[model samples]
Target: MQIGHDAIIIGGGFYGAAIAVYLVRQRGLKRVVLIEREPALMTRASYNNQARVHNGYHYPRSFTTAYRSRINLPKFVQEWPTAVKQDFTKLYAIARRNSKVTAKQFERFCRDIGADIRVADPALRGLFEPRLIEKIYVVKEYVFDATKLARLAEQELRQAGVQLIYDTSVTAVSKGVDIPLQVALHNKQGVQELLTSQFVFNCTYSGLNQLSGDFSGVCSGLKQEITEMALMQMPESLCGLGVTVMDGPFFSLMPFPSCGLHTLSHVRYTPHMHWSDQRGIDPYEKLRGYHKETRVDRMVRDAARYMPELLKAEYKESLFEVKTILNKNESDDGRPILFEKHMDLPGCYSVLGGKIDNIYDVLEKLDEVI
Candidate 1:
C-alpha cells in the first residue's frame, strides 16, 4: 500500500519540524508529514547538547561560522524569546598557555564578527586562576531550554496542520514510479508501509546516509561521535555564571535551563570515540553497543586547574548522544551547515547543521529549492 504527500520529512528534530512548518505555513504547501524514530521531538541530539545559543564568541578560528552566528543569534532569540535563558553571565576565558587563540586575537575576532564582548567584572574574573587564565570577557550569549523549544515546535506543527508519525523508522528510500521519491517505513508493531512524496528531506542528523542506500554518495564526508555531556549542580559561587576556557583541550560549564543544572563538557574528554561515514558504519548501533561511563571526575579535575571552584560541583548525570559533523570542517573547527541536493535522486535532499541557530542558513537554502 502507498500513501502520498507533498513532502515527507524523515526526522522530527528541530530542523525537520521547522522545515515542515515552514513549508505549510510559509510556503503554503498543504500536504506535509514529519517522521521520527523516537516517540517525540527533540529527544536526541537536540536535547542532549550543551544547549548554547551561539553568539560568535565560540568560533574565533572560523570567521564564517562566527559571523553567521553573530547574524543569526538575535533572530533566534527574538523568535523564541521565552525559551531563551539570559539570566546567567556568559564568560569566555583565554588560557595563558596551550590556547590556539590568545586573548588579543579572540578580542579581535569577536570585534570582527560584531559580537558583543567586554571585559568581565572583577569579581567574575576573580573566579578563575589568574596565572592560568590570561583574560576573561563577558560575552552576550544565551542558553536555550530545549524542552520549551520542543513544546513550541509541537504547537507550531499542530497549528500548521503537519501530520506527525512517531516511533517509526525509514528503512530505505528510492525513486518513485508516480512521485519524486518513495520511502519505506517500519513501525514498532513490525508493520511496513510505503510513502511517496514530491520531495523527501533526510534531516536525520547522524542517520543522514542510513536510508539513502545507493544514493549515499550525496551524504558523504560525514563524521559521527559518541559524546557525553555531564550535568552537575554548580557551587554557590558559580551558580549564576557560565564559564568556558577557550581554544584548547579545556572545559565549559554552562547553565542547562531545562533541569536547572549546569552542563560540563571537556574538549578532550567529551567524545568517547568517532568514526567517518565513508566506511558505511552504523553509528547508532555502535552507540548502543558501547558502554557509557561518566567522565565528570576527569573533567572537573582538569578544569579545576584553571578554576578552582569547579572542584565543588556535584555530578548529577550524563547525557549521551551521537554528535555528527561535516568531515571537511574538522581542521579549523568550522561549523558551516551542510545542505546537499542529490542530482542522481532528484527531489531528495540531506541537511545537517552544527549549531541550532544555523537553522537560518538551512531555511535560506530551502527558499531557493522549495
Candidate 2:
C-alpha cells in the first residue's frame, strides 16, 4: 500500500527534524512526514560531537563561516532559548608554539566578525600554562544541551502536525508516475512499505548520497570522518569554564550540558579516519565495520600540556559519529552549508550542514525553493 503526502523528509537528525517543523509550521504544509531509522530524533550526529552553538570564534581561519555563525548565533539562541547553556565562561587560548593564528590575529578576527571577545581575567588565565599559551580571551559563546534540543524538536514537530515515522529506513527513492517521488521503506523485521510524496528532502547528513535511484550524483565533493568526542568530569578549576586552544593541533574542552559532563576533543586526535564520499562508499557502513578505541588518554595528555588543570579531569566515555564536510573545506577549514536542487529529479533537494547554527542557511535556501 502506498501513502501520499505533500512532503517526505528522510533522516531524522536535527536538520531533518527542523526542516520538517519549518515546512509544517512556517510554510503551512499539512501533509508532511519525517522518517527515521532510529526510534527517536537527534540520536545520531546531533547528540554526539561537542554540542557547541558557534559564535564565530571557532572559525578564525574562515571569515565567511565565522561571519555566518555570527549572524545565525542570535537567531538560534532566540529560537531555542531553553536549550542554550550560557552559565559557563568560554575561553579561547592561542598556543605560543605551532599555532596557525597568532593571539592578535585571533583577536582581530573575532572583532572583525563582530563577536564579543575580551582578554581573560588573571584568575582564568592562571588555569593555563603561560609558557605554552600566548593569550587567553574570554568569548561570548554557548554550548547546547542536545537532549533538550531533541525534546524541543520533537515537541515542535508534533505540534506542527508532522507525521512522525520512526524505526523505518528509506531503501530507495525513485521517480513516481503519479507523485513526484516514491520512497521505499523497510523496518528491522523486514517489513516493507511504500510512500509517495510531491516533494522529497534529503536531509541525511552522512548518508546524504547513500540512497539509490534519483539520489545518485545529487551530492558530490563530500568527505566523511569517524570522529570521537570524549566526555569527562572537569576538574574544580575548569568546571565552570570552557577552553579551546586555537588554530592548529590543539584541543577543546567544553560543558556538554545534557550529560552534566564536559566534552574533550583534539584537532589531531578527534578524527580517527576519513574517506571521500565521491568514491560511492556508504559512511554508515564504514562506521559500523570499523573498530573504535578510546583516545581520551591522548587527548587529555596533549590538552593538559596547554592547560595543566586538565590532568585532573575524570574520563567518563566517548561519543563517536560520522562527521561529514565539503571536500573543498579541507583547504581553508570553512563550513558552508550545501544545498543542492536536482535538475534531473524534480521536487528533490539535498542539504548538508556542518554547524548546528548553520540551520538558518538551510532554512533560507529552502525558503527560496519551497
Can you write out model 2's per-residue Cα lDDT over 239-335, one digit (the tens) per residue? 9989899889999888999999999999999999998785368887888888989899999899988888899999988898999999889978999
Residue 285 shift from truth in candidate 1, angstroms: 1.6
Candidate 2 similarity to native, TM-score: 0.98
Per-residue lDDT tens digits for candidate 1, residues 254-307, read: 999999999999999999999887435777788888999878889999999999
Q: Which pairs of residues clash in candidate 2, taking residues 3 or more apart in a chain or in different chains?
A: none
RMSD of each: 1.1, 1.1
Report how far residue 94 has shifted in candidate 2, in Å.
0.6
